[model samples]
Target: MPSHVAPTTAEVYRAHLADASTSSDVFAAGLAEEPAAALVNALAGLDDPPTVRLLVTETVAKWLRRDFHLASTAADLLAAETLSLRVADGSFANQMVVTADAVASILSTDEQTAGPATDDPEFVDSMRERCSEAWETAEPFDLRTPPRSRVYETLGDEIDPAVEADYQAMLDAVETTRSNGYRTTDDDRFDEVELVLLAGAKHELQHYDLSRWGEDVGLASKATFSRTKNRLEDQGLLTTEKVPIDIGRPRQRLVLDDRLRDVEAGDLPEAGRDVIDSATE
Candidate 1:
C-alpha cells in the first residue's frame, strides 16, 4: 500500500498531475522560476512514465539522503526516470547518467516482477494500461490518471530535448530488460563500475576541486569509492599524481591516462563486452 503520511513528494506531484490547468510547458517555465524547489515540487503526482517515476524517486531519495527535505517515498517507484529526465534536460550534471541508468534498469526489473498479479481485475487492467503507455511515450506523458495529469500540467513544458532523448533511451532499456527476464547481480555491478568511471573521469578532468570525486558522486560510499578508484587505476583509466594544491601541502590529483581516454572514446570495450564493459561504454 502506498503511504499517505501528509503528502509525500510523489503525492504533491500527483496533485499537480490531477489539475487540468497544468502542462509540460508550464512545468518547464517553472524550472527557471523556482529552480530546485520548483523542480522538486513539479515532481509531485507523477503516476505514468514509469521511467520518469523511477528517476524521480531515486533523485528524491538521494536528495533526501543528502538532506534536501521533501517528504515522501512513493517516488521510489520512479526514481531512475527522474534522474534520466534531469540528465536529458541539462538540469543536472553529467555524472548522474551511469548511476541513473544502472539503478533505473534495476527498478524496471523490480517493477515488472512486483506487478499486480493478485489485484482486482479492474485495478490490474488500469495498471496494465499505465505500463503500456509508460513504455511507449516520452516525458510529459499522460497516465490516464488525474494525478499524472496535474503533474504534467505543472512540469511538462520545461523538459528539454536532451532529457527527452535520454528518457526515451531509458524507457527502451527498461522495456528490453523487462521482456528478457534475465536479472543478475552482474548487471548491478557493471552499473556501479560505470558510475565509478564517470566520477573518476570527472575528477580527472578537474570538474570539481574536491579531494574525493568518486565519493561526491553520491552513489558510492567512501569505501566503495576507494575500491573503484583503485580498480580504475589498475585498469589504466586513471593515474594518480602528487600535486601541490596548497603551497606547503601536497595532494593526490587524479589524471586521466591518454590510453584510457582512447579506450573510453574508442570502440575497444563495448557495454556488454564483459562484466565491466558497461563502465567504459
Candidate 2:
C-alpha cells in the first residue's frame, strides 16, 4: 500500500479554480478575519488567478481587491450557516469544504497543511444552496486598492523621466502602507489622494506644484488635492509655502507639518491615523 499524501492549502484553492478561466464563483464561509484576509491576499498573489464572484461575511469583506467580485452577508448569519467548515465552491462540478485546521493553514508561511475535501454532489448542492440564500441578502462591496496598471494608465505619457523614479517610489510606499493593513477607504483614515500627497511631501522633500502633483499621481483632480491639502493644513498635519514660477501663478509647495517632520517614512500611515484619531477625540 502507498502512503497517502496531503495537498497543500494553496494547491487546494488552485485546484478549485483550475477550470476558472471559463468563469467560477467561490463561496467562502466560516473564516476568521485574519485567515479570511490571508485567503484573498493569497489568491491575489497567484500568477494567473481567475476573477471569481466571492461570497463572504461582512467582517471579512473589509479586505478589498485588485481582482474578484465581492459580496458579503451579515456575520452572524454566515457563521450559523457554515459553522466550522470553510467552503469555496468553484462550480457545480468542483466544490471544496475544509475544516478549521485547513482554513488556518492558509495563513501559514510554511507549506500549508491540506484539510480533507469532499466533492459529493449532494453535499456540494446543499452548501451551494446555503450560500445562495446568503447571497440574496449580501451587499456588494467596492472598496478596493486601485490596480497598478490603472494608476499608470491614468498618469498617461506626460510624466517627466527625471521624476519618474520619484513617482514609482511613492506608488511603492502606498502599496507598503496597504500591505501593512491601512485602507484608504476607511473613513477615519486618510483617503488615497491624501496619502499620495503626504507621501510625496514627506519623502521627496522637493517642493512639487500641488496641482501638477495631483496629475502626476493620477489619483484625483487638482481641486480635490487642493481641498484635501487645506483640510490637512487646518488639522495641523501639513503645511505649504508659495513658490514663484515664471509661468502662470505661483504654485503651493506641500510640506509636512513640524509634528510629522521627524516621523519615519514607513510610520506615516499609522502616524497619520493617530493624528486623525487625536483630532477627532
Best by TM-score: 2
Worst 10 residues of 1 by lDDT: 97-106
Error of 1 at 250 (Å): 2.5
Model 1 agreement with the true structure over 24-59: per-residue lDDT tens digits: 211111122112333345444354422222222233
The TM-score obtained by model 1 is 0.32
Model 2 ranges off by over 4 Å = 1-12, 19-23, 63-115, 156-167, 170-195, 198-241, 244-249, 254-281
Which lDDT tens digits does candidate 2 get at residues 1-281? 11112344545555544433423345555454444544554454456654434555544555433212211112212222221222233222322332211111123336453434555556656776766675565666544333444444443444333233444444444432223333332345455566656765675333344456455544446777767677777776778778778998776677887778787665766677677677777
Q: Residue 138: error of model 2 in Å?
A: 1.4
> How do all models score by TM-score?
0.32, 0.51
Clashes of 1: 41
RMSD of each: 17.0, 9.7
The global Cα lDDT (0 to 1) of model 2 is 0.48
* Superposed model 1: Cα runs more than 4 Å off: 1-189, 206-217, 247-249, 263-281
TM-score of 2: 0.51
